[model samples]
Target: MALPTGPATSWLQRTGFPSQLFETGDNDYELYEAEDEFVLSVEMPGFEPDEMNVSWSDGVLNIVAEHEDEQRDRRETYHRRFRFPKDVAEDEITAKYTNGILEVRLPVMRGATVSGTEIEIQG
Candidate 1:
């Protein structure tokens, strides 16, 4: 079978970095922008809702999870590391987990420019 061109071809030709490789393993995410809010979707497989921690601090959204050690006697091996984006507001972030997916909604702050009109005064 053949693949599409343009962006898909570019993505295929480029060599992935360490972070990109790690991101593909266990960290799949999506960001959506709307008129009033920004949504972030994170794919967390094989993890319970209670086991993950979501927080926003200093304009950075941090998501962390610590898996329980299944074997207490033997040491475990680490495979990958995923890096999250650091451009989101931490204080305005809210998250919910259902069906093995974590969805976070962040409300846009005030100070955005909106169209308006000024009334003329008649003398």
Candidate 2:
């Protein structure tokens, strides 16, 4: 697809996805871990609830949204994936979309811990 133009640009061209988010220097998608759950909020506008899909598989969260402008013959698509550091209760995971923001909550399983080794800088 052709890149967005300077003038007459639509919201689809602004923050339609992770691609345009960096240009604005704002946290379009925010992710943080609370005491018991991981929360993530993504900025996505101009899309109806039915036009989006949120799913979880293999410790990863996937978000996909699309908008089609039939009159203009244009299609907009957004896809993003997030991998968790700790084990999550996949069955209890939930998500919601409101006012253009998609928020997902992943409950961390009890006694589940992150497995990783920290690396030290070598001189």
Best by TM-score: 2
Q: Write model 2 residue lDDT over 1-123, tens digit each, in one string.
A: 865434335564454332332233256699999999999999988778899999999888988888887675566667788899899999999988999998899999999998689889999
Q: Each candidate's TM vs. the true structure?
A: 0.54, 0.74
Backbone N/Cα/C clashes per model: 1, 0
RMSD of each: 11.8, 5.7
Candidate 2 vs. true structure, TM-score:
0.74
Q: Where's the lowest-lDDT run of ten residues in candidate 1?
A: 73-82
Q: In model 2, what is the error at residue 27, expressed in angstroms? A: 3.1
The candidate maximizing lDDT is 2
- Candidate 2's C-alpha lDDT? 0.80
